[model samples]
Target: MRIINPNLENKLKKFGSDTAHICFNCGTCAAICPLFETSFPRKFMRYIQIGAEDKIMDEKLELFKCLHCGLCTSSCPKGADPGEVMLGLKRFVLDKLRRNQDV
Candidate 1:
Protein backbone atom coordinates (compact mmCIF):
# COMPACT_ATOMS: atom_id res chain seq x y z
CA MET A 1 0.00 0.00 0.00
CA ARG A 2 2.38 2.67 -1.16
CA ILE A 3 1.24 6.16 -2.04
CA ILE A 4 3.11 7.83 -4.89
CA ASN A 5 3.80 11.53 -4.89
CA PRO A 6 4.68 12.59 -8.42
CA ASN A 7 6.46 15.64 -7.07
CA LEU A 8 9.05 13.63 -5.15
CA GLU A 9 11.40 13.48 -8.13
CA ASN A 10 11.31 17.25 -8.50
CA LYS A 11 11.89 17.72 -4.78
CA LEU A 12 14.92 15.43 -4.91
CA LYS A 13 16.48 17.59 -7.60
CA LYS A 14 17.32 20.19 -4.96
CA PHE A 15 19.36 17.54 -3.18
CA GLY A 16 21.30 16.64 -6.36
CA SER A 17 19.19 13.72 -7.59
CA ASP A 18 18.27 15.24 -10.93
CA THR A 19 18.62 12.12 -13.10
CA ALA A 20 16.78 9.48 -11.14
CA HIS A 21 13.83 9.47 -13.48
CA ILE A 22 16.06 8.65 -16.41
CA CYS A 23 16.76 5.19 -15.03
CA PHE A 24 14.69 2.40 -16.52
CA ASN A 25 15.42 -0.21 -13.79
CA CYS A 26 17.66 -2.35 -16.00
CA GLY A 27 19.48 -3.68 -12.87
CA THR A 28 22.91 -2.84 -14.27
CA CYS A 29 23.79 -0.74 -11.26
CA ALA A 30 23.02 -3.59 -8.90
CA ALA A 31 24.99 -6.05 -11.00
CA ILE A 32 28.03 -3.85 -10.96
CA CYS A 33 27.89 -3.08 -7.25
CA PRO A 34 30.41 -5.06 -5.20
CA LEU A 35 28.70 -4.42 -1.89
CA PHE A 36 25.37 -5.87 -0.88
CA GLU A 37 24.12 -9.11 -2.36
CA THR A 38 20.68 -7.63 -2.73
CA SER A 39 19.49 -5.17 -5.36
CA PHE A 40 21.36 -2.36 -3.59
CA PRO A 41 21.66 0.56 -6.02
CA ARG A 42 18.94 -0.52 -8.42
CA LYS A 43 16.36 -0.82 -5.66
CA PHE A 44 17.00 2.70 -4.43
CA MET A 45 16.93 4.08 -7.96
CA ARG A 46 13.57 2.47 -8.63
CA TYR A 47 12.19 3.88 -5.39
CA ILE A 48 13.10 7.40 -6.48
CA GLN A 49 11.73 6.99 -10.00
CA ILE A 50 8.35 5.86 -8.65
CA GLY A 51 8.28 8.48 -5.90
CA ALA A 52 8.35 5.97 -3.08
CA GLU A 53 9.43 8.53 -0.53
CA ASP A 54 8.21 6.63 2.52
CA LYS A 55 10.06 3.52 1.42
CA ILE A 56 13.18 5.53 0.79
CA MET A 57 12.96 7.05 4.25
CA ASP A 58 12.41 3.66 5.83
CA GLU A 59 15.55 2.28 4.21
CA LYS A 60 17.53 5.47 4.57
CA LEU A 61 20.40 3.70 6.30
CA GLU A 62 21.10 1.74 3.15
CA LEU A 63 22.13 4.92 1.39
CA PHE A 64 25.17 5.15 3.63
CA LYS A 65 26.19 1.69 2.56
CA CYS A 66 26.98 2.76 -0.99
CA LEU A 67 30.72 2.61 -1.69
CA HIS A 68 30.69 5.17 -4.55
CA CYS A 69 32.97 2.76 -6.43
CA GLY A 70 31.96 4.27 -9.79
CA LEU A 71 31.16 0.85 -11.17
CA CYS A 72 27.44 1.46 -11.01
CA THR A 73 27.76 4.86 -12.61
CA SER A 74 29.90 3.64 -15.48
CA SER A 75 27.88 0.52 -16.10
CA CYS A 76 24.55 2.29 -16.33
CA PRO A 77 23.56 2.56 -19.99
CA LYS A 78 21.08 5.37 -19.31
CA GLY A 79 23.73 7.55 -17.68
CA ALA A 80 21.50 7.84 -14.62
CA ASP A 81 24.48 8.02 -12.26
CA PRO A 82 23.08 5.92 -9.46
CA GLY A 83 26.10 6.68 -7.30
CA GLU A 84 25.41 10.39 -7.41
CA VAL A 85 21.73 9.82 -6.78
CA MET A 86 22.61 7.76 -3.71
CA LEU A 87 24.71 10.62 -2.41
CA GLY A 88 21.84 12.99 -3.05
CA LEU A 89 19.53 10.75 -1.09
CA LYS A 90 21.91 10.92 1.86
CA ARG A 91 21.76 14.69 1.80
CA PHE A 92 18.00 14.69 1.41
CA VAL A 93 17.49 12.31 4.34
CA LEU A 94 19.79 14.28 6.60
CA ASP A 95 18.00 17.50 5.74
CA LYS A 96 14.63 15.95 6.49
CA LEU A 97 15.87 14.66 9.82
CA ARG A 98 17.26 18.04 10.72
CA ARG A 99 14.00 19.75 9.78
CA ASN A 100 12.03 17.29 11.85
CA GLN A 101 14.20 17.95 14.86
CA ASP A 102 13.85 21.71 14.47
CA VAL A 103 10.11 21.46 14.87
Candidate 2:
Protein backbone atom coordinates (compact mmCIF):
# COMPACT_ATOMS: atom_id res chain seq x y z
CA MET A 1 0.00 0.00 0.00
CA ARG A 2 3.03 2.24 -0.32
CA ILE A 3 1.75 3.10 -3.75
CA ILE A 4 1.02 6.84 -3.67
CA ASN A 5 -2.02 7.75 -5.63
CA PRO A 6 -0.93 9.75 -8.70
CA ASN A 7 -4.07 11.79 -9.14
CA LEU A 8 -4.49 11.82 -5.43
CA GLU A 9 -1.61 14.23 -5.16
CA ASN A 10 -3.24 16.84 -7.37
CA LYS A 11 -6.55 15.86 -5.99
CA LEU A 12 -5.14 16.63 -2.62
CA LYS A 13 -2.67 19.29 -3.75
CA LYS A 14 -3.87 21.90 -1.32
CA PHE A 15 -4.15 19.03 1.10
CA GLY A 16 -0.60 17.84 0.40
CA SER A 17 0.56 14.50 -0.92
CA ASP A 18 0.07 12.61 2.32
CA THR A 19 -1.35 14.74 5.14
CA ALA A 20 -2.98 17.40 3.00
CA HIS A 21 -3.40 20.83 4.55
CA ILE A 22 -7.01 20.19 3.74
CA CYS A 23 -7.43 19.01 7.29
CA PHE A 24 -9.63 21.69 8.84
CA ASN A 25 -9.05 20.48 12.42
CA CYS A 26 -12.78 20.83 12.87
CA GLY A 27 -12.70 17.96 15.37
CA THR A 28 -15.43 16.20 13.45
CA CYS A 29 -12.94 13.43 12.98
CA ALA A 30 -11.87 13.55 16.58
CA ALA A 31 -15.40 13.99 17.87
CA ILE A 32 -16.86 11.09 15.92
CA CYS A 33 -13.66 9.10 16.17
CA PRO A 34 -13.82 6.11 18.57
CA LEU A 35 -10.24 6.10 19.77
CA PHE A 36 -10.99 6.55 23.48
CA GLU A 37 -10.15 10.26 23.14
CA THR A 38 -6.59 9.36 22.19
CA SER A 39 -6.80 10.15 18.47
CA PHE A 40 -5.69 13.30 16.70
CA PRO A 41 -6.22 12.81 12.99
CA ARG A 42 -5.76 16.47 12.02
CA LYS A 43 -2.28 16.75 13.39
CA PHE A 44 -1.46 13.20 12.41
CA MET A 45 -2.46 13.82 8.81
CA ARG A 46 -0.27 16.92 8.57
CA TYR A 47 2.78 15.16 9.92
CA ILE A 48 2.42 12.20 7.59
CA GLN A 49 2.14 14.19 4.35
CA ILE A 50 4.92 16.63 5.12
CA GLY A 51 7.34 13.70 5.22
CA ALA A 52 7.84 14.44 8.89
CA GLU A 53 9.56 11.12 9.25
CA ASP A 54 11.27 12.04 12.48
CA LYS A 55 8.12 13.34 14.09
CA ILE A 56 6.14 10.36 12.93
CA MET A 57 8.82 8.04 14.31
CA ASP A 58 8.81 9.85 17.61
CA GLU A 59 5.01 9.78 17.74
CA LYS A 60 4.82 6.09 16.88
CA LEU A 61 2.79 5.27 19.97
CA GLU A 62 0.18 7.90 19.16
CA LEU A 63 -0.03 6.63 15.60
CA PHE A 64 -0.54 3.07 16.77
CA LYS A 65 -3.36 4.26 18.99
CA CYS A 66 -5.41 4.70 15.85
CA LEU A 67 -8.05 2.00 15.38
CA HIS A 68 -8.40 2.73 11.62
CA CYS A 69 -12.15 2.58 12.09
CA GLY A 70 -12.83 4.71 8.96
CA LEU A 71 -15.33 6.95 10.74
CA CYS A 72 -13.06 9.81 9.80
CA THR A 73 -13.24 8.72 6.20
CA SER A 74 -17.01 8.71 6.24
CA SER A 75 -17.13 12.28 7.44
CA CYS A 76 -14.13 13.66 5.58
CA PRO A 77 -15.32 16.05 2.91
CA LYS A 78 -11.91 16.03 1.24
CA GLY A 79 -11.92 12.25 1.21
CA ALA A 80 -8.65 12.35 3.06
CA ASP A 81 -8.39 9.20 5.13
CA PRO A 82 -6.01 9.79 8.03
CA GLY A 83 -6.98 6.62 9.87
CA GLU A 84 -5.98 4.05 7.26
CA VAL A 85 -2.83 5.94 6.34
CA MET A 86 -1.79 5.90 9.96
CA LEU A 87 -2.43 2.17 10.07
CA GLY A 88 -0.36 1.70 6.94
CA LEU A 89 2.57 3.48 8.51
CA LYS A 90 2.16 1.44 11.67
CA ARG A 91 2.13 -1.79 9.70
CA PHE A 92 5.08 -0.80 7.57
CA VAL A 93 7.20 0.39 10.44
CA LEU A 94 6.31 -2.56 12.70
CA ASP A 95 7.11 -5.04 9.96
CA LYS A 96 10.51 -3.47 9.41
CA LEU A 97 11.14 -3.08 13.11
CA ARG A 98 10.19 -6.71 13.78
CA ARG A 99 12.39 -7.91 10.96
CA ASN A 100 15.38 -6.06 12.42
CA GLN A 101 14.59 -7.36 15.90
CA ASP A 102 14.63 -10.91 14.50
CA VAL A 103 18.26 -10.50 13.51
Candidate 3:
Protein backbone atom coordinates (compact mmCIF):
# COMPACT_ATOMS: atom_id res chain seq x y z
CA MET A 1 0.00 0.00 0.00
CA ARG A 2 1.41 3.35 -1.04
CA ILE A 3 0.91 6.26 1.31
CA ILE A 4 0.91 9.74 -0.18
CA ASN A 5 2.97 12.40 1.45
CA PRO A 6 1.89 15.88 0.36
CA ASN A 7 5.32 17.24 1.12
CA LEU A 8 7.13 14.90 -1.25
CA GLU A 9 7.86 17.68 -3.73
CA ASN A 10 9.42 19.83 -1.05
CA LYS A 11 11.47 16.85 0.14
CA LEU A 12 12.66 16.21 -3.42
CA LYS A 13 13.86 19.79 -3.89
CA LYS A 14 16.69 19.22 -1.41
CA PHE A 15 18.21 16.63 -3.72
CA GLY A 16 17.97 19.10 -6.64
CA SER A 17 15.55 19.82 -9.47
CA ASP A 18 13.56 22.44 -7.62
CA THR A 19 11.30 22.49 -10.65
CA ALA A 20 10.13 18.94 -9.91
CA HIS A 21 6.54 20.02 -9.34
CA ILE A 22 6.39 22.01 -12.56
CA CYS A 23 5.71 19.00 -14.73
CA PHE A 24 2.15 18.85 -16.12
CA ASN A 25 2.34 15.20 -17.27
CA CYS A 26 2.45 16.02 -21.00
CA GLY A 27 4.13 12.66 -21.77
CA THR A 28 6.56 14.40 -24.13
CA CYS A 29 9.43 13.19 -21.99
CA ALA A 30 8.28 9.60 -22.27
CA ALA A 31 7.73 9.93 -26.02
CA ILE A 32 11.34 11.00 -26.52
CA CYS A 33 12.98 8.58 -24.10
CA PRO A 34 15.19 6.15 -26.02
CA LEU A 35 15.97 3.86 -23.12
CA PHE A 36 12.54 2.38 -22.50
CA GLU A 37 9.39 1.59 -24.45
CA THR A 38 7.34 2.59 -21.40
CA SER A 39 7.13 6.07 -19.98
CA PHE A 40 10.38 6.91 -18.22
CA PRO A 41 10.73 10.40 -16.72
CA ARG A 42 7.03 11.18 -16.97
CA LYS A 43 6.25 8.28 -14.67
CA PHE A 44 8.72 9.55 -12.11
CA MET A 45 7.57 13.13 -12.60
CA ARG A 46 3.98 12.19 -11.92
CA TYR A 47 4.94 10.32 -8.81
CA ILE A 48 6.67 13.42 -7.52
CA GLN A 49 3.86 15.77 -8.50
CA ILE A 50 1.24 13.63 -6.80
CA GLY A 51 3.29 13.30 -3.64
CA ALA A 52 3.57 9.56 -4.15
CA GLU A 53 6.66 9.06 -2.04
CA ASP A 54 6.03 5.37 -1.40
CA LYS A 55 5.45 4.74 -5.09
CA ILE A 56 8.71 6.47 -5.93
CA MET A 57 10.61 4.31 -3.47
CA ASP A 58 8.90 1.18 -4.65
CA GLU A 59 9.88 1.88 -8.24
CA LYS A 60 13.27 3.36 -7.50
CA LEU A 61 15.13 0.82 -9.61
CA GLU A 62 13.39 2.12 -12.71
CA LEU A 63 15.19 5.40 -12.13
CA PHE A 64 18.53 3.79 -13.06
CA LYS A 65 17.27 2.89 -16.51
CA CYS A 66 17.44 6.54 -17.47
CA LEU A 67 20.19 7.19 -20.03
CA HIS A 68 20.27 10.91 -19.05
CA CYS A 69 20.92 11.81 -22.70
CA GLY A 70 19.04 15.11 -22.21
CA LEU A 71 16.39 14.22 -24.77
CA CYS A 72 13.63 14.18 -22.13
CA THR A 73 14.74 17.47 -20.67
CA SER A 74 15.02 19.07 -24.07
CA SER A 75 11.63 17.82 -25.15
CA CYS A 76 9.72 18.85 -22.03
CA PRO A 77 7.46 21.75 -23.02
CA LYS A 78 7.02 22.75 -19.37
CA GLY A 79 10.75 23.14 -18.73
CA ALA A 80 10.36 20.52 -16.01
CA ASP A 81 13.89 19.23 -16.87
CA PRO A 82 13.03 15.57 -16.47
CA GLY A 83 16.67 14.56 -16.72
CA GLU A 84 17.54 16.74 -13.75
CA VAL A 85 14.55 15.36 -11.88
CA MET A 86 15.74 11.82 -12.47
CA LEU A 87 19.17 12.67 -11.13
CA GLY A 88 17.58 14.27 -8.09
CA LEU A 89 15.48 11.15 -7.53
CA LYS A 90 18.60 8.99 -7.63
CA ARG A 91 20.10 11.09 -4.89
CA PHE A 92 16.84 11.04 -2.91
CA VAL A 93 16.57 7.26 -3.14
CA LEU A 94 20.19 6.77 -2.19
CA ASP A 95 19.79 9.00 0.84
CA LYS A 96 16.68 7.14 1.91
CA LEU A 97 18.45 3.79 1.53
CA ARG A 98 21.43 5.03 3.50
CA ARG A 99 19.25 6.34 6.30
CA ASN A 100 17.36 3.07 6.45
CA GLN A 101 20.62 1.12 6.71
CA ASP A 102 21.79 3.30 9.56
CA VAL A 103 18.58 2.84 11.50
Candidate 4:
Protein backbone atom coordinates (compact mmCIF):
# COMPACT_ATOMS: atom_id res chain seq x y z
CA MET A 1 0.00 0.00 0.00
CA ARG A 2 1.41 3.35 -0.97
CA ILE A 3 0.28 5.72 1.72
CA ILE A 4 0.49 9.32 0.69
CA ASN A 5 -0.01 12.56 2.49
CA PRO A 6 -0.81 15.09 -0.20
CA ASN A 7 -0.42 17.91 2.24
CA LEU A 8 3.14 17.07 3.19
CA GLU A 9 4.79 19.20 0.54
CA ASN A 10 2.75 22.19 1.53
CA LYS A 11 3.49 21.62 5.19
CA LEU A 12 7.22 21.39 4.51
CA LYS A 13 7.12 24.57 2.50
CA LYS A 14 6.01 26.41 5.63
CA PHE A 15 9.02 25.13 7.56
CA GLY A 16 11.92 25.54 5.14
CA SER A 17 13.20 27.63 2.23
CA ASP A 18 9.98 27.02 0.20
CA THR A 19 12.22 26.25 -2.79
CA ALA A 20 12.01 22.46 -2.49
CA HIS A 21 9.50 22.41 -5.33
CA ILE A 22 12.29 23.78 -7.50
CA CYS A 23 14.35 20.66 -7.04
CA PHE A 24 14.77 18.76 -10.28
CA ASN A 25 16.27 15.68 -8.57
CA CYS A 26 19.65 16.77 -9.98
CA GLY A 27 21.50 14.86 -7.18
CA THR A 28 23.89 17.77 -6.63
CA CYS A 29 22.89 18.04 -2.97
CA ALA A 30 23.45 14.36 -2.35
CA ALA A 31 26.71 14.38 -4.29
CA ILE A 32 28.17 17.17 -2.18
CA CYS A 33 26.89 16.01 1.20
CA PRO A 34 29.49 14.73 3.64
CA LEU A 35 27.03 11.97 4.56
CA PHE A 36 26.60 10.71 1.04
CA GLU A 37 26.51 7.14 2.30
CA THR A 38 22.89 7.73 3.24
CA SER A 39 22.00 10.04 0.29
CA PHE A 40 20.82 12.67 2.77
CA PRO A 41 19.30 15.68 1.07
CA ARG A 42 18.23 14.31 -2.31
CA LYS A 43 16.44 11.26 -0.98
CA PHE A 44 14.76 13.23 1.74
CA MET A 45 13.82 15.95 -0.74
CA ARG A 46 12.21 13.35 -2.97
CA TYR A 47 10.19 12.01 -0.09
CA ILE A 48 8.93 15.48 0.71
CA GLN A 49 8.11 16.44 -2.85
CA ILE A 50 6.30 13.18 -3.44
CA GLY A 51 4.43 13.37 -0.13
CA ALA A 52 5.82 10.08 1.04
CA GLU A 53 5.00 10.64 4.68
CA ASP A 54 5.41 6.98 5.56
CA LYS A 55 8.84 6.85 3.96
CA ILE A 56 9.81 10.10 5.59
CA MET A 57 8.78 8.74 8.97
CA ASP A 58 10.53 5.46 8.30
CA GLU A 59 13.85 7.20 7.65
CA LYS A 60 13.88 9.23 10.81
CA LEU A 61 17.37 8.08 11.73
CA GLU A 62 18.74 9.11 8.36
CA LEU A 63 17.14 12.50 8.80
CA PHE A 64 18.97 13.01 12.07
CA LYS A 65 22.29 12.18 10.42
CA CYS A 66 22.36 15.59 8.84
CA LEU A 67 25.18 17.67 10.32
CA HIS A 68 23.54 20.92 9.15
CA CYS A 69 26.89 21.64 7.51
CA GLY A 70 25.26 23.81 4.83
CA LEU A 71 27.26 22.12 2.07
CA CYS A 72 24.08 20.70 0.54
CA THR A 73 22.54 24.15 0.40
CA SER A 74 25.67 25.67 -1.05
CA SER A 75 25.89 22.99 -3.71
CA CYS A 76 22.21 22.95 -4.71
CA PRO A 77 21.81 24.31 -8.24
CA LYS A 78 18.21 25.39 -7.59
CA GLY A 79 18.76 27.21 -4.31
CA ALA A 80 16.62 24.58 -2.63
CA ASP A 81 18.37 24.97 0.72
CA PRO A 82 18.39 21.23 1.37
CA GLY A 83 20.03 21.73 4.75
CA GLU A 84 16.98 23.62 5.90
CA VAL A 85 14.82 20.87 4.41
CA MET A 86 16.63 18.33 6.57
CA LEU A 87 15.97 20.47 9.62
CA GLY A 88 12.32 20.66 8.63
CA LEU A 89 12.16 16.89 8.34
CA LYS A 90 13.60 16.60 11.82
CA ARG A 91 10.93 18.94 13.10
CA PHE A 92 8.24 16.98 11.24
CA VAL A 93 9.42 13.74 12.78
CA LEU A 94 9.51 15.21 16.24
CA ASP A 95 6.02 16.55 15.86
CA LYS A 96 4.79 13.20 14.60
CA LEU A 97 6.35 11.45 17.59
CA ARG A 98 4.83 13.91 20.00
CA ARG A 99 1.40 13.48 18.47
CA ASN A 100 1.64 9.74 18.77
CA GLN A 101 2.71 9.80 22.40
CA ASP A 102 0.16 8.98 25.09
CA VAL A 103 -0.12 11.48 27.89
lDDT of 4 by residue, 39-99 (tens): 6689888887888988988778778889999998888888888888888888878877889
lDDT of 2: 0.61
Residue range with the least summed lDDT across 10 consecutive positions in model 4:
12-21
Arrange candidates by TM-score, highest first: which order?
3, 1, 4, 2
Q: Count clashes in each candidate, considering only residues at least 3 apart in sequence or on different chains.
A: 0, 3, 0, 0
lDDT of 1 at 73: 92
State the weakest 10-residue window (summed lDDT) of model 3: 35-44
Better of 2 and 4 by lDDT: 4
Q: How far is 101's C-alpha from truth in model 2 (Å)?
A: 3.7
TM-score of each: 0.91, 0.63, 0.92, 0.89
> Which pairs of residues clash in candidate 2, taking residues 3 or more apart in a chain or in different chains?
15-20, 15-21, 19-49
Error of 3 at 57 (Å): 0.8
RMSD of each: 1.9, 7.4, 1.8, 2.1
Candidate numbers sorted by lDDT from highest down: 1, 3, 4, 2
Error of 1 at 102 (Å): 9.9
The candidate scoring highest on lDDT is 1
User: Poorest 10 consecutive residues of model 2 by lDDT?
Assistant: 8-17
Assess candidate 1 and give its TM-score to the true structure.
0.91
